[model samples]
Target chain A: MCGIVGLFLKKPELRPQLGAHLQTMLVGMTDRGPDSAGIAVYHRPVEANQCKLTTFHANPDYPWRKLGGQLAEALNAEVDVEIKANHAVITVGAAEGSARAWITRSHPEVRIMGYGQLMEVYKDMGLPADVARRYSLEGMEGSHAIGHTRMATESAVTTEHSHPFTAAPDMCLVHNGSLSNHNNLRKWLRRRGLEFETDNDSEVAARYFAYRLGEGATLAEALEAGLRDLDGFYTFTMGTRDGFAVLRDGIACKPAVLAETDDWVAMASEFRSLANLPGVEKANIWEPEPAVVYTWSLQEAA
Target chain B: MNTIDLSKTPVRELNQRLHDLTPDTNERLWRITNLKGEHALAVGLTVPIEVEIDGHVGYYCAGMNKEAKVVITGHCGVGVAENIMSGEVRVKGNASQAAAASGHGGLVVIEGDASARCGISMKGVDIVVGGSVGHMSAFMGQSGSLVVCGDAGQSLGDSIYEARLYVQGSVESLGSDCIEKEMTPHHLAKLERLLSRAGIEADPRRFRRYGSARRLYSFHVDQAEQY
Candidate 1:
């Protein structure tokens, strides 16, 4: 079982309060999942041609400035870095693939959490409140964000197992229920050469969506394929650069509630997480139907 | 009236306060405000008191209740009164999956539709859905009566045993081993009582009764395809 919360600000003015609102909502779900917490915020968008990567280092006091300078020297491009706790956001003025490959080949101790234009992820093994505090989530700003608080059923209670699994650029996913066929799916994905970071089921689901998306499938198409391929009781919340989506399994055993207002759109495993959002009373609150693809996006064109 | 605001109060504290209440407590009415869909709220309440929740609630809002009456003025998430032993839990709005799953005794009423498996694995409880119900409701119901004032989704009362099902509207399809039985006078009388108790005013004659065919009770080689 886990707690998942997401918010997409319909109004640009709410960007400043995005983290504050998300912090309260995530903290409200402390009891539902007490072990670990994770959050992915799509903050200030870099230029369309540039990308940013959020990385995690095992050593908390690792010299990030030196790494930033080394990355700049190797890539021959200016890099901007911001260190938060054991994680750091390195914004480079280049394509995502080359920098990703450079980091993977160079820094063996550093693991990439996410890579995208605006997404920055922070997750760790601790209480939601504590993790949020460590990330200074209240001060962060974004147009949208997705958060998760995990209660491990099969995987180990480690930071790596914490959710908001991001296997694609500007894409993150969170899940509430365990997958029934993850072990087999893991082997299949591995055979297809999709690398996995942990023995977590939600990661596979995210990677599956990422793979489908990478193959040029739209978010809706990829999610529909997930429904056809994946076998489990899952209530998934996914975030992309310009899109947000929610889906449930055929049986829809796991709980998910959605509320949309003029100002923002929110989703949670329960209502408690959404209650604290502004203008909630007037929001059109309802439960997402089973086996339906509910998606919202800023890219209204096409 | 004892009011606990969930905005400032943790769910554990609220449940602990409800758990500490005795039948003879001085306070008779407890108002829980700003629930904001918190899970396990008022869970395991044994007192014979009444709790009125102002807003929405999360999973298992009144789960495993006993004697206490918990009313939700807003919609509820999954398993509103799951594993309910005894008590009256009322939802003013729709309920999510398995609204009264595995309830043993007492009555659970949902003013709005409930999702799939509303009474899955139920045991001796009365569930009244003011609106429609989703697919596979009462999947493994052992005993009790499920009254749906509106239409029922697919596989109503699948693999049911002994429990009686009453649907005022159309049933999408019957489950395996479950058949629409003739609404005898005795069953109609029971349906009337249930409808009246649930504050539903539909005519009892419009309703149909469904129950087990008793064929699946004992395994037979000829009925192997049914499994």
Candidate 2:
């Protein structure tokens, strides 16, 4: 079991405030999952934004820093580059919107996990408040964001297993519950040459959604594809560069709640998490029907 | 008695207030009304506080209770008094299935009827239902006593261990490997003690006992065909 939350603000100026409210919502749902926590925020770029691509390797013998430096040198010929750990946050002059695609073509196995003005993904095994403070989550800002608090049952408890797992640029997902047909889906995806880092079923789901989106399908269309094809219990919220979308499994073995207003849309695993939101009204709160796809768009923001 | 009203207070705060109270410190009484099927009501209590809920609860009401006494003024949903380690839970109205299910130790007295699979997979808790129980009552019963003052439903005591079943009325049907047993003086004594604890004045002599025949414990090729 795990908890996922997301918020899409209609007004770009309210992005910082929405981030603060999402932090409170995540803290309220800390009990559902106490393992690890991560967040992804989508911010509109000004002119050119830096993108960080971090990859976790199983082999400790590999020279991670040297590899990052070499990638930076190659990317710097086209733009300015800075390296940190196993990551290289590149700020390109020409590749404004194409940073994600360029990185994908250059490094096939390595994913452009995050892309935006500010995208930080950190994992820690503890209470949500403790983990958030440790990761400095309060300083995060964006127009829309998605987060996950993991309770590791099916997979190993590690940073590699922590979510908001990004399969491509500007596409990240946080999921709850297990996929019953994960093994079958894994074999099919592997046959299509899709690489998987962890054995988690959530990764497979992310890949499935990414595959659909890559085929020129809209976010809603890709989510509908998941509802038709994916089996078993799951409730997920995917964060994109513009907005976020939420989906629930057919039987709804897990729980999820959605609350929306004129200015903001918020979601969590329980209503208690959204109880104290700044502008939340009691009547606007409702639970998502089982197997139904519900989406909130920041594009409608004033 | 000290009375606390739960009309406007949040359930979490109410539970916290209940948890902080002590038995000898004060005789605490609470009137929880307008409860719209909330989960974990009055859960994980150790003090000797008495709580009276005015309406139905969703799940795990009085769960993991110890020392405190709880009385539901109205009907209860699933897993009421579930996994009760000690103390007593008296339901004034009909209880849903799995009442006192998986309870390790304690006493549950249902003044009204209990639904299907009552005390299913009971560990050691004693349950006394004044009205008839539904089908599969005490299915996979491990140990403890389930005394149904009314009729027992079908498949009663299926796959049962050492737990005993005493019913005053007729049994709809027996589960596999279960058969009626003689209610001797020893059984009468046990029933009397349990009935007295539940504050029921019914005579133990009129009731009959049912238990596992122990024929299904070992495998036999001849019995395999019968199954």
| DockQ per candidate, 2 decimals | 0.55, 0.04
In angstroms, the error of model 2 at A171 is: 1.0
* Predicted complex 2: CAPRI docking category: incorrect
Per-residue C-alpha lDDT of model 1 across residues B112-198, encoded as one tens digit per residue: 888888899999889999988988999889999999989998899998987889999999899999998999999989888877777
Task: Judge candidate 1 against the unseen true structure and give its global Cα lDDT, from 0 to 1.
Answer: 0.89
lDDT of 2 by residue, A135-158 (tens): 455776777777888888877777
TM-scores for chain B, listed for all candidates = 0.94, 0.89
Which pairs of residues clash in candidate 2, taking residues 3 or more apart in a chain or in different chains?
none
lDDT of each: 0.89, 0.75
> How many residue pairs in model 2 have overlapping backbones?
0
Candidate 1 TM-score versus the reference: 0.87
- lDDT, residue B61, candidate 1: 88
Q: Lowest summed-lDDT stretch of 10 residues in model 1 chain B?
A: B217-226
What is the per-residue lDDT of model 1 for residues A234-253, given as tens digits with 9 covering 90 to 100?
Answer: 99999999978999998887
True contacts kept of each: 0.60, 0.00
